[model samples]
Target: MVKVEIVEEKDQQSSANSPYASTSSSRHSSQESISSISSELSAEETLYDRINALVDIVPPATRHRISTKVSKAVSFVKTGGKIMGNIVWIVTTSALLVGLPLALSLEDEAKIVAQEREMMAQQQGAQQMLSPGSAYPPPPGSNQTPQKGIVPPGF
Candidate 1:
């Protein structure tokens, strides 16, 4: 029949346009993808349900004990934090109140002592320069003779 030949010709054209195209295979692949997506969604829901179900299975006494232990641990951590904070505050305050001034005073004392030593050295040099003796006196602890060409042992 002419209609049958037309349908056969249209099918041949479709196959020529795309050699690998097939309606059955496309439907099967789409079905597989849809089923896989649904399975994943169901798996997630099942996991959520399982987790929510755990709340009903624990006994009240066990839950109470767990809660009490958690509360005690929290309180202990809070107390320790407060104590450590107080200790740090005390140390910093003491350093500012006591240690800073002590360090400054010690540094000032050292500077004063150094200045006095320099002044004393200058005074001794001036006294030596003003003296009328032709030769300066030997230092108290000296053992070396003051001969003109004498060299110290190390030098």
Candidate 2:
């Protein structure tokens, strides 16, 4: 009975290890690489499998085209210098376009500031010249003249 039990266990282990124990698995290659990659994918799949499938598609045409474009771009950059001459030209032109107006406006601003200072100084001078006795001088015979004919308070 013990010998029979040992034989049964060994059979079950071999059955489990086949990988093609289920019907879904296909192609049993004897090469070491193919044998090593026996476990291709699983039945209960994930998002990673879907994404990997998308990247694994290698059409011969797209690969060649992509590599050619990359090599062409590399060669062009190696021949040409880092900075494009047109960019420097455009930058200088734009600086002059924008800076000229600002430079001209600064001169006008100085003139306007000087005119404002002169007007304020004139106003201050006029205020200084005003009499301390009266902002508006009274007409001739105003109230409370303190004359000889007038009666004094409490008199």
Candidate 3:
């Protein structure tokens, strides 16, 4: 509830001139002023005043129940958000802790296997170049025949 007071100053010249005005005339003027002021105040009612009047129509118990329910709903949403954040953090952390090491180990094993294969191929090529009865034809003036079933490097 709000209380408003409106004060207006009377004209001294008018009062002095109407020092002997009839009592009926004074009463009429006072009633007219009161009515005009009331009308003006009603027309200028604030949004807060209208809403407060509307809320007053509802029962107190119902308002209390609605407020409590709304508060509970807000708290539940907050809790769920926190839980979701924690789950995401745990998942990402676990992936970095476990998956990362396994991937690195697999990559290193692949590199080692590739290096071993390369070393074997080099050894085979050296042996072929040094062997007398290789896949290639013999040197000039030399009496040697090509091998029967040896495949060249390209094949």
Candidate 4:
């Protein structure tokens, strides 16, 4: 049962739009009321101003309750931070897991390709060694010497 009288003070009702004033009883002695009050005031208020006012006048016990609630909420939110840390480790390990095998397999494919190229080159070299005698056709009556057996390198 809080009773309020708008005194002739300048800044008295300045914070009237505050939460305490808005949420509490508006027992403001109106201009045409039983007890004729002097100044005429409008009732326009915003939520922040009201909340600030309530915080200012809150009793110690109620304030403690509010503080405890806020702390609990903060700790709950930070509980997810632990999971986030683990998630980073999981993601990095998974990426390495996927990438390592792929890189190793690609290296194997490259080795196969190189081995195939070496085999082809060796086959071409062997063919060249086996087939001799070039493009100079005997002019008129030129006699050519016969070539010998074609043995590969390590034989």
Strongest candidate by TM-score: 1
| Angstrom error at residue 24, model 2 | 81
- Give per-residue CA lDDT, model 1, range 69-148, as digits (tens): 99999999999999999999999999999999999999999999999999999997778645543144456676544446
TM-score of each: 0.54, 0.31, 0.50, 0.37
Tens digits of per-residue lDDT, candidate 4, 50-105, equal 66777768898999998999999999889888889899999989889998899999
Q: Rank the candidates by TM-score, best first.
A: 1, 3, 4, 2
Angstrom error of the Cα, residue 91, model 4: value is 1.6
User: Of the pair 2 and 3, which is ahead by TM-score?
Assistant: 3
Which pairs, if any, clash in model 1? none
**What are the runs in model 4 whose C-alpha is more than 4 Å off?**
1-77, 133-155
lDDT of 2 by residue, 1-155 (tens): 35543434547668768765743434433454476763556667776877767755867688789889999999889666446666787898888999888889999999999999999999975764353333344346665333245343357
| Candidate 3 lDDT score at position 73 | 97
List model 3 lDDT by residue over 45-115, tens digit each.
Answer: 97688788888888999999999999999999999999999999999999999999999999999999999
Per-model C-alpha lDDT, please?
0.77, 0.68, 0.83, 0.71
Note each model's CA RMSD in angstroms: 19.9, 18.0, 13.2, 13.9
Segments of candidate 1 deviating more than 4 angstroms: 1-52, 132-155
RMSD of 1: 19.9
Q: Which parts of model 2 have CA positions greater than 4 angstroms off?
A: 1-83, 133-155
